[model samples]
Target: MTGSFGATSTTDEVLAGVDLSGKRILVTGVSAGLGVETARVLAAHGAQVVGAARDLAKAKGATEEVRAQAKNGGGLELVELDLASLKSVRACADALVAAGKPFDIVIANAGVMATPFGKTADGFETQFGTNHLGHFVLVNRIASLMKPGSRLVNLSSSGHRFSDVDLEDPNFDHTPYAEFIAYGRSKTANVLFAVEFDRRHKARGVRATAVHPGGIQTELGRYMTPEVLQGLVDSINANQPAGAQFSWKTIPQGAATSVWAGVVAEADLVGAHFCEDCHVAEIVEGVDIRAGVRSYALDPERAKALWAKSEAMVGERF
Candidate 1:
């Protein structure tokens, strides 16, 4: 179950010839960038895509854009979801479940990156709350509605290289908070989440995977200073001495791996694998970040522990 696709691949390219006529797909953070492109391509392939976002206006606008690009019109729908609030997640999940629609694919593609220290309405750290816990609860709440062969894709990032999950202080309760560290911890949780989720749910015919969409200039980087952004460019250049200094995929390219995981038949076979550039990435070592999954990111014990803790924190069980 190799998951590799090329860097130049787009959503349409990955979805080519795949007909999703009766499938229903839910993509969070679909208001912009890779999320929008993912929804557009899925809808084009005949999946009834619900573009979930915090803002109804933005969701509607993004849905329209996706609708315009859809070969089969009316395949896109707008749904409200605010990951920053667990209450909102509950409400949205309830609404969807009440509608009696079972989602065949769920791509947890929405997240905040490197934002200033803050907390969700539930008093959890913003990044961990919105990026990890919110999706955790949402998936658990909706797990009952998922029929056999359904898939859930958690959007992780190479930033998992930055840090592992901090069990002692996930909410930064006892330590000084750093934005990048918080973001990294959250992303690492994203990977472990999929790993443990697959462990628990795959036996029931559901599968979960995590993906690192290669760095693209998107709203996800809205909080970074120009110096920080340029510093990343400089670092990439310096690290890849044998290659181009900076390599970035377009939003469509960045979204390809996720879209592929959502619809590709081979995806189920590669459950719990961390993917990047549309493939099961090789594990890397020695702090050189260009290659593989970090040791900390794939710890099965850690994944299970985190899952238990998350269930405790959210007060729910799947």
Candidate 2:
């Protein structure tokens, strides 16, 4: 399945002719953008989708359209989740565990981007808390529900190339806060989470992987200013030939790789890898390689370390 698809692939295209009847999927951040599209397309293919959002009312209203899109035994439902708060994460996981329905796929698709400095209710840096530790606690709490042959897709970002997790200072406690760096570390944490989780759970027949959905125009960029955006573009293209255009993918294109990861039964994809354009991404060799996994993000030792630290922070060990 290597490079079978590219940035232009649509969610519908990756899933065309695939039957997901009897499959139940859990998708976070399903209120808008890629998450909504992911749920809709999977449901369209006959998967029962349980979408999680911070606001149940908003989720209920938004998922109405997703429910309408369901066909052939496909359906959509809602669950309340606030990833910025540990209590909310536990409640969401508890509710799902109580339901006793195991998911065929769980997509950790919700996340915040480079927002200004702030702390989550848990007193951790906002991005690291919501994007990484939040899912960390939620997943560990409900891991029993992810049975053998299940997939967990964590939505990472190409921004992971920007930096590695500062384990000792993950909350920017003693260091000056930089929004992009925090975001980068969190995204890196996403990849490492999948890595260690897969290593630990593979024998149980469970697998995990992280995905880079490519650049897209979405609310995820709500905190991004023009100056920041231009700086990123300049940094990414710094070594490339002049006049080469930087591009953004459409929403469907952004969701394609995730949908692919959720359903593809390839054993080759069972390990932790940074995926992009529907395939495992290779590191671009240079001073400014922005399209693939950084070595630090995939280090098994670091992954294990992060897991331990996260468990300590959340006061639970899984």
Q: lDDT scores for all predictions?
A: 0.85, 0.88
Q: Who wins the lDDT comparison? A: 2
Model 2 lDDT tens row, 112-152: 99999999998999999999999998888888999899988
Span of 10 residues, lowest total lDDT, candidate 1: 283-292
Error of 1 at 129 (Å): 0.6
Distance from true location, Cα of 54 in model 2, Å: 0.3
Worst 10 residues of 2 by lDDT: 283-292
List, residue by residue over 191-296, the lDDT tens digit for candidate 1. 9999998888888889988998888999999999999998877776677757545577998899998977777737565588888777777777644455568877
Clash counts for the predictions, in order: 3, 0
